[model samples]
Target: MAPEYLLWAAVLYVGAAVGSFLNVVIHRVPLGESVVKPRSRCPACRTTIAWYDNIPVLSWLALRGKCRGCGTGISGRYPFIEFITALIALVLFARLGLSIAFGVQFAFSCALIVVAYIDLDHQIIPDKISLPGIVLGLLAAIPGGMPAMTDAVLGVLLGGGLLLTVAWVYERSTGREGMGGGDVKLLAMIGAFLGWQGVLLTLLLGSLLGSAIGLVLMASQGADRKLAIPFGPFLSLGALVTLFWGHAIVRWYISYAGLAEI
Candidate 1:
């Protein structure tokens, strides 16, 4: 086999293994349970899963998405998360090669995946993830060779401060909480990694996507009231888009909008 192909395969396997661990985090973090010490188990029967039966996507396929102990249905989410993680690893590898950039961005992407899924299930963005994430994101600048540290700090301030001010103004005007504190922290974390440009793009795109989806859901249900929608997933999606294509999108806009000179 080609060496390049072998390297790609290795990345996929590692990514999948990490994905499996992320599954544990997703289940345990929201519940305040320890992720370590407890081996993988069948949720239905609480039977400890053997190593052979816990091999990422393969295990799910082998068991046909059923718990071997109780024959209860297992969530398809496991394999899906694994697959997505593997794909992300491969794509990041392709885009950045086997470099520090790949490693840091890969980790950031994984955290975003965990954050997105958890927020979807619990309507929360965990402080455990986002809080440390902001700090680590700033640190990533030194080793990851990303935006300048000053830009990163500005990004954090802009991201967090912008949303906070909005939420405050919104509450004062309507006497209702318009946004969650979790989202502010989440944006701050994103800004730490991607810098101010990324912060702006994520906010704009995330808002558009969230608004469209929220409207559609409410329309489908014929509800005039605001739905209890978690905005984290849309924000995650926006961050991912910015991570991959922000520069390209910005360049395109600059050229198309006749701002190439300035």
Candidate 2:
């Protein structure tokens, strides 16, 4: 096997391990539980999960997605998240190679996974992740990171402020809240990492994706916009897309529009 393949495999293994920890974060953060302590256990039987049984995707397959202690069914999402996280890491590695950029973006990606899942299950994005993320994003820029320091700062302000203004306008017009604070902060954190341009692209992508999904759900279920679909997952996905393909996307849009690339 090529040395490059060996390195890629190592990254995949590390990414899956990190994803396993992310599972704990997603499950515990929203519930106000400590993710660090109280070693992983079977929720059904309260048996501590041994290290061998906790091997990311393989253990779940070996156990057939069941708790070995009590034979209780485990959600497939566990292995799914691990696999997806590994894939995302591999993609980032391929794109950015082994550098500070990869480290920053990978951490940001992991946080997004945590935020996305938590929002999906609980309709909330925890400040515990976003607030610190904002700071971290800003710091990441110091090391020749994405978009430079100035862009990152602007991303924070514009990202948070743009959504905040829309939310305010929406609430005033409808006499009801249309957006959550969590979404705003999540975008802000995205801006911190991707910069103001990223914020715009992420918003456009997220809105388009969310709107399409919303229309489908409403049509199929005979529900309305009041159905309360969580937006964090869409936004997280958009951010990931932007991180990976933002520059190419920008160039394409410019060329397609017959505008000179800036």
lDDT string for model 1 (110-160, tens) is: 889999999999999999999898898898887436977888888899999
Which ten-residue region of model 1 has the weakest summed lDDT? 140-149
Q: How many clashing residue pairs, candidate 1?
A: 0
In model 1, the runs with Cα more than 4 Å from the true position are none
Error of 1 at 156 (Å): 0.5
Give all TM-scores, in the order shown: 0.94, 0.95
lDDT tens digits by residue: candidate 2, 64-153: 999998999999999999998999889989988989888888999999999999999999999999999999999988856677999999
**Alpha-carbon shift of residue 225 in model 2 (angstroms):** 3.0
Clashing residue pairs in candidate 2 (N, C-alpha, C atoms within 3 angstroms): none
lDDT for 143 (candidate 2): 57
Model 2 whole-model lDDT (C-alpha atoms): 0.94
Question: Where is model 2 poorest over a 10-residue stretch in terms of lDDT?
Answer: 139-148
Score each candidate by Cα lDDT.
0.91, 0.94
Model 1: colliding residue pairs: none
